[model samples]
Target: MRIGILGSGNVAKSLSRGFVARGDEVRLGTRTGSKAQLAAWIAEQHLAIAQGTLEGVTGWAEAIVLAMRGMANPETVRAAGEPAFRGKVVIDATNPLVWRADGFPSLGLPEPESAGARLQKDLPGAKVVKAFNTIGHAHMVRPQFANPPTMFICGDDPTAKTWVTELLRDFGWSSIVDVGGIERSRLLESLCVLWITCGMRLENWNIAMRLEQRI
Candidate 1:
């Protein structure tokens, strides 16, 4: 699989590493196309990931991952161009988090609207799935826990969700829950606030949510 991830941040790097580990060709899209900026990190990690401009990567990839900051979605879309995303499954791994002075974060968007929904609206031609937002980047792939955590995802397109679920399994997830359409992203984004609050209170940054079913 050819994966194009937008952003050069932690989330992008983590996902890129995971995809590469699974024998997928990964390319990271950055604001700048200069490979020199990410060359050192790539060599240090010893991963064969490529770097390119946003538009270039989007055109080259079979699938795209929006790993940019929540607020930067519009700009990212503009930078990558809308037409390039048509018929591609875009994994939205963003949270519309508004950080405050006390170090706590809140949702930037109001009810019934979320980053995932907005992305879907922005890229109507693409299949957008909300995922990888409720967990930390370090534990995104092959997380080790007493019990495997459930990856809750939502999207209007069932096929896209299915694709993401299979990818999650490849990344070592045994349990996955599809929480309905993109509108359900409101709930998942709120879940991120809860995750952050718990991490701050417990002073532990390595926590994940698990749904224990009675089945």
Candidate 2:
């Protein structure tokens, strides 16, 4: 599968490497096509092409990974050309984080909505699946915490969620949990805030959530 990733940050880099390792064609989208470090990293890893704009990357991909800031997704949509994203399986890994003076970090989304839900609404024709937002980028690739950590994925499109589940398995996710449709995205994004606070308060960045199951 050909994967297009928006943003040139750590999450994007880690996922790009993961896809390349899994033998999938990966293209990275960023504001600048030639960031020397990123270019060098891609070359060193022998990963896929890195393009300056979202349209170029999306044009080369069968699916897209939305790794940009939650607040910046709309702009990314405009930059990628809304029509181009139509009917494509867009894996949304963004969290709705709002920089506010609340007791702790909080979400930018409305009380009942999530970043993934907003993306789905904005791109009505596109299939948006919410995945990879609850965990930190460091644990995203080949996670091995002595136990199989759970990855909670949600989407309105069952096929899209299945594709994401398969992709997660390839990246070493042994426990895959479906949290239901696009509406559940709000809950997933909130989990990020909770995780962050726990990490900070406990000084345990390495710790992440997992779902236990038994027969």
Candidate 3:
């Protein structure tokens, strides 16, 4: 699989490593069109990944991952060009976060409006799925816990969601829950706030959410 990740940040690097580990060709697309820092980091990590501009990577990838900051979604998509995303599955791993003076985070968007939902609107030609936002990047791939944590995802496209579910499995997630369409991202993004609050209070960044079923 050819995967294009938009952003050179921690989340993009983490997901690139996971994709490469799974034998997928990965590329890091930067919004700034400058690759000096990203190239150095790639060499330092000894990863088999390529770096390019947003538009170039989007055209080259079979699937795309939006790993940029939540507020930068519109700009990133505009730089990448929406036409390039048609017929592709785009994994939205962003959260509309606003930090308080005390350092706590809150959702920037109001009810019924979420990063995932906005991305879907921005790229109507692409299948957008909300995922990888409720947990830390450190535990994104193959999280180790007493019981496997659940990856909750939502999207309007059934095929896209199925593809993302399989990708999650490849990344070592055993339990995945589909919470519904992209609109449900409101709940999922809120879940991130809870996750962060717990981590801050417990002073632990390794925790993940799990769902236990009676069945």
Candidate 4:
């Protein structure tokens, strides 16, 4: 599958390399048209990946990953445009985090209360699935723990969730849980905050969560 990741940050770089390593075509999108870091990444992974504006990537790939910072908000989504994302499965890996004066991060949304919810409202034609928010980018792919960590995903469209679950599986997530609809994004994004706080307190980014099931 051809995937377009709309960010220049660590998440975009991580997922881009992971997908390409698994033999999928990848394009990374950022507001800037620069390709310096992306070029280095391509060489490091020993694979080719295209880099372009978010608008360019949206049209070039079969799937899109919303890997940008949540602070960009409506303008960022607007910049990418609706036509580019129409009828596509968008894996939303963003959180609505804003640093407070006290040096703690907090959710920035007011009501419908999640970055994923806002994305769905703005991009009605896109199938938005929320995943990969509760873990660090470093651990997103091929993570090794005593037990495999679970990835929580939610989207309005069941088919879209299934498709994203399969992609998550391919990315080395053995436990992908579909936790209902896009509304669940509020909780999922908060879970990211929890993960961040735990990491800060424990002084370790390697800690991860794995749901234990009695099946």
Candidate 5:
């Protein structure tokens, strides 16, 4: 699979590496100034190509990963052109988080529902699924947990959800839990707060969430 990731930040780069490791091609998209960094990463990792513009990548990839800043998703859509994402499974790994006056992060989704819902609204032609938002970038793929962590995924399109599940499996996840439709994205997004707060308070960022059950 050819994956195009919008944003050269940590999340995007981390996912790109994971995809490439799983033998899927990757094209990292970024602004002109970020291309050098992207190029360095590509060379260092010896992965696939990198594009300087959003349109460049959107056209090249079979699937898209919207790993950009949550508030900037609309801009990414406009830059990539709405028509390019039609019928493609877009993995949304964003959270609409903003620091509040109390020095804690909070959801700032303009759509007031969830980031997945908001992205679906922004790219009506695209199939958007919420995932990879509950964990840190370093632990995105093949996490070093005591046990396999649970990945909570949700999307309106069942087919899209299945597709993302396959991809996540390839990335070394074996415990993926489908929590429900896109509306449930709110819960996943909010989970980030707990993950972050616990990490900060405990002074540990290497921990992860695992769903345990009795046989």
Candidate 6:
């Protein structure tokens, strides 16, 4: 599958390499039309293409990964042209991280409606599946915990969620729990804050989370 990741950050780079190593064609999208780092990455990975303009990447990919900032998602989609994402499965890996005046995190989306919810409404026909938002980029690609970690995914489209769960499995995430529907994206997005806080506050634990089944 051809995956288009819309970001130039650590998450984009990590996922890009992971997908490429797994034999999927990966193209990363950036606002800036620069290819220097992307070129180096392609050479290092032995992959032909690496980065592209937002529209270029979206046009070339069968699936789109909305891996940009949550606040920037609307603009990124707008810039990429909403039609490019129509009827496509978009794997959303963003969080609502607003910088408060008191220098803290705030919610980017208002109550009842989450960032992913807003994204789904805005994109219309796009199948928006929320995944990869709760984990750190360092552990996103081929995470090697003593026990394989769980990846929580939610989307209104069941087929899209299934496809994304398989993709997560390819990334070394064995346990996939479909948290049910797109509205659950709110809890998943907030999980990022809690995960970040714990990782920063605690000294012993690295980036890791296991979803256990007691049944």
RMSD to native for every prediction? 1.0, 1.7, 1.0, 1.4, 1.7, 1.9
Q: Tens digit of lDDT per residue, candidate 3, span 58-134?
A: 99999999999997899999999999999999999999899989999999988879999999999999999999999
Residue range 1-215, candidate 5, lDDT tens digits:
88889988999989988887888888878755257767887788776665657898888889999999987788888888989999999999998888888777778864448888878888888888999999999999988787999999998899999999998898889999999888788898888878887887888989889898889
lDDT of each: 0.94, 0.86, 0.94, 0.87, 0.86, 0.84
lDDT of candidate 5 at residue 119, scale 0 to 100: 81
lDDT of 4 by residue, 71-100 (tens): 675777888888888999999999989888
Candidate 4 off by > 4 Å: none
Residue 56 displacement (Å), model 1: 0.8
Q: Candidate 3, 132: how far from true, in Å?
A: 0.8
Q: After superposition, how far is residue 165 of candidate 5 from its true place, in Å?
A: 0.8
Whole-model lDDT, candidate 2?
0.86
Q: Kindly report the root-mean-square deviation of model 3 from the true structure over all alpha carbons.
A: 1.0
- Report clashes for each candidate as comma-separated counts: 0, 0, 0, 0, 0, 0
Which residue pairs clash in candidate 5? none
- Expressed as tens digits, the lDDT of each residue in 1-215 for candidate 6 is 88899987878888887887888988888998566876776687676556789998988889998888888888998889988988899989999788777554656787776878888988888999999988889889888788888788899999999889888888888888899999989988888867776765774335777788799
Q: What TM-score does structure 3 among the candidates reach? A: 0.97
Off by over 4 Å in 2: 44-48
